[model samples]
Target chain A: MKRNLRIMVIDDENIVGKRLKPALEKEGDIVETFTDARNALERFSEQQFDIVVSDIRMDDIDGLEVLEQVLARSEKTKVIIITGYATVEVAQEALVKGAFDFIAKPFKPNDLRTIIEKAAKELGR
Target chain B: MNITSGEAPIQTDDPQFSHHGLGEEYVEDIALKSRPIISIRFRLFLAFLVIFAFSMIVALWSIYALSEIQVKIRFLEAAGNYLTEIQQARRFEKNFLLYGTNLEDSLEHLRTAESILQKNKDTIEKILGRNSIQGMSLQLNNYHKVLEKVGEAGDTEERNRYEPELREYGGQLVSDATNFVVKEREAVEDALSLSRRVPFYFLGILMVLIIVITSFLVKNILSTLNRFLEYTNRIGEGDFSPILPKRKYRDEFSQLGLAFNHMIRELDKRHKILIESHKLRAVGTLVAGVAHELNNPLNNTMLTAGLLEEDFERLPDEEKLDMVQDIIKETERSKVIVRNLLDFARASDYKIIAMDLENLLEGSIRLVHNRVKLAKIELQMKLTPDLPPVHGDEQALQQVFINLILNAVDALPPRGKITVTDSKSSQAGFIEIKVSDNGPGIPEHILPRIFDPFFTTKVKEKGTGLGLSVSQGFVRRLGGNITVESRVGGGTTFTVLLPTTEVPSSVSAAPSP
Candidate 1:
């Protein structure tokens, strides 16, 4: 049997991280949630994750910076960007900047689950 | 996805708006209409006619006086010739009496004097009266008879008797003639001198009249001009009071006042429309942020409820209650976001009240929070605590700060910095707030025109260029001012100085007597 996936979620909206924790855990994965992107990034620096999900906009730092730092640490880890009022330009820029995929806000857990599944298959796990 | 419309609609409040120029409009209209028309041209004509009529009277009087003097001169000349003739007869009488010359010569001279008197008798009568002329004629007749008797005398004794009578008559008649001529000459001289002085007095009176008329006309025109100047300044300050007639008679200036009132009404109407459109534009900009902000809570509620539904059968009752509570909290958050925006978007009359600047700034910060986030710009606030309250309209001042923030956001690149700081101003009785941005500064050449209406550096579709202009207008109306400083490479800062409200100045703040 394959090892369980290590996943991380970062959103300023605390509920986004709270709800996602249990939902991803149900799918036989280890999920760590953070309301602060800086804290999540600090934790990422100490540990390794198979995937990192972050909101595009936040108070202190943005998701794109988080994406850049994560990719710099380990290029193999996949990054999924979450955006509110997502425009075409932002989505295209996220893809060009090496984000695995971009998702608009108010998406169901299953929708994120599908994108994660595709990333997981690419990892061959 | 469609907005959650199932919940009871939240918009129950009225849209606050009013026609600013419509107050007391009918009263002003009636005041302008209740006047008679009299053009300035007619007034000038009337003034000229008065002067013309006065000059004609003076001219006629002067002509009559001169003609009378001419008649007196002619009479004096005739009377002088009659006097000369009488003196010649007297001299010839002496030659006849002393040198024993022929008495015919004296008689001839006396007869000539009599003929001269006869020729000028009617004129002399008109001048000296008919009674005086008859007296002079009687003396002349007696002198002539005495001279003729001497010519007819047969011996020396008869001639000697006539000689004494001739001498008495001759001396008396000549004296009377000389006295009449001298008196008439003096009278003619007095008339001539009077006629010369009459023209000088008329000129002096004419000068005084011209001065009076000129000052009357000039004062009317110039004072009206000065008043119109004041009206233009009033309009510039956004006062749209119509001009009313101030004079008894309506003249060209009254028509001009009416024209000014018409222009004021039109300008006021246009200004109201511009303000309305500017508000709508501001509302549009705010709505986008509101819509984006609304999604967060909606998403939270959706996720919480959706998961709760899917796990309803498996989840514990405590967990279900927690999910329901989360859903409630998120819905409530959405309501607050919408309400704040709605309050700003609604129009209201100018209501100046003592307001807390710090609290107002916080509200404005919240309105532009999402825009600031989306642009990836860092916004900081350093408000002075317990600052003196300022008199201002809440909605208007809110719009002003939002415009400043949005403009800064537009100018800044991602990761740029914006700091909003407030402090006591250098000028007393004012508080200064500065919105500074670390964006590529505006070029110096176009900086002066940034607040001009319809002057824009932004693209045509993206901007109507009224944001700064309208913001400045609002601030100025509140007894405040907005200023800007920028460099080519250095960042830009907009400083707003607002007047602090003094205690007990407001009508409501004052204690009743």
Candidate 2:
């Protein structure tokens, strides 16, 4: 039996969080979505997750900062950055901060599924 | 003919006054335009002809008057010679009588001398007749008869009996000779005076005529030319309403004025037509831009509806999961189209900030990648690693790059290559972006109008033509420069120069020079 993996999605867009929640849930993962990075960070402080997927640009806090906060709390936890505003700098920065991989916006559901599986495997979930 | 080298005397030749307030380039262009493509040589030749004709006429008149003076001088000279000869003859006759050298013998000698004198008189009349020594033949004949009467007294005794008569005859001879001498001297003086006075008068009259003729010519031609120049200056200053006046003489200037008037009328009509066309094109561009914005969301809606229709049939089955994937994909597509539509139609208050240049360029490239793929154009980028940040709005700069990329794609034939390059210009303190194409370049006539709003080389249906112009506006708003260089049939290059500054979180920093 595959244990249900814990996943947190941080994105400003309501539709993205809404759609992505069910999609990740259908992959047999316990999914959590926070439209606010600050709230997500507060939630992240009290809990543990198998993987964290963050959008690069948000109204309150950027993905790089989100990566920083998450790494500060738990360096071993997997961080997969998802962003519409992907660039070499963002990718390199996210990767250097111990993110799993960087995915661009409008990504296929399979891409998300694959990344989350990799994170699950990395975590031995 | 001498060009005065001393400070060039304020150059009235340069028509511009300081107050007209145009740039040096514009003024220089105006000045160059003022000197039309008229043949300077022809004008010089015409001026020379007028002067030469006047000089030749003066020369001919002077020659005629001088020749008349020469004739009078010759006539006076001949008369002077004749008077001197007559006085010599009388002196010779007196010398013979005073010395009482051989009375009857001298009278015989005198007769022989008279015969010699008569022969010489014939020669004198012959020479004087060819000259203008008028009325001198009769005087010579009278002097010859006086000598004959003195010589016809055959003997000295007969001569002594008629001594008083001889003395009286001698008195008459001396008196007649003196009177003749006085008359001839007077005639010679009159002729010499006439010779001197007539030439002076003729020369004076000739000088006056030359002055009058040259003044008339210069006034007539220069005033006419000044009028032409004034009108041309007005035309150059964009004032085209002057009615070109005609001359009754039907000269070359008149013909040129008529032709110029016709040309200006034609140009004015063409300019009006061009203005109207430009307005129509602007309206068309607005309509097309609106249409393109509307079309994107419409397309997304159609794709979304199609996916929903497909997904409704696959429910409650093993492939229901596949149908969910399809729905998600379709929804993402709809989101993309909606986002693009908003970006295109959104009113923007762009703000500039110091941003990482490499990141900005990559983002712009990603934004336009789908279009590049759709156009079948290759997008080649060569971004220098560790490049500095630039001061600009990322979105606006992205729009500029996309506009240039789209323009390049349209300019190219299918599958052609478009290269986007980035490099640091140390001297400019800016990041230079070059988007170049290997397409057939813009036509020569259309090159200047490339950045004008609504001026398009593409067909009416194919382009709204606001891309380059809007790019220019955006670049300018960001305190940057965007310019295009095109070679007909070779290719086109769009260069965007953006001011570079410090990036906040970058590791390596460039030294400020």
Predicted model with the maximum DockQ: 1
lDDT of 2 by residue, B301-372 (tens): 333344445445644665456545655665665565456444433444555567766666666675566556
In model 1, which runs have C-alpha deviations exceeding 4 angstroms? Answer: A1-3, A42-48, A72-76, B1-26, B29-39, B84-138, B141-156, B182-216, B244-249, B347-361, B375-394, B400-513
Q: Could you give the DockQ of candidate 1?
A: 0.53
Residue-level lDDT tens digits of model 1 in B353-375: 88778878888899898889878
- Can you write out model 1's per-residue Cα lDDT over A88-124, one digit (the tens) per residue? 9888888999999988988877778889989999999
User: For residue A66, what is the lDDT in candidate 1?
Assistant: 91
List clashing residue pairs in candidate 1.
Answer: B16-B347
lDDT over C-alpha atoms for residue B404 of model 1: 92
Q: Report the alpha-carbon TM-score of model 2 versus the true structure.
A: 0.42
Off by over 4 Å in 2: A1-6, A26-30, A42-50, A59-61, A85-93, A108-110, B1-38, B46-77, B95-143, B153-513
Per-residue lDDT of B505 in model 1 = 51
- List lDDT for all candidates, in order: 0.81, 0.61
Residue B317, model 2: Cα distance from true site in angstroms: 16
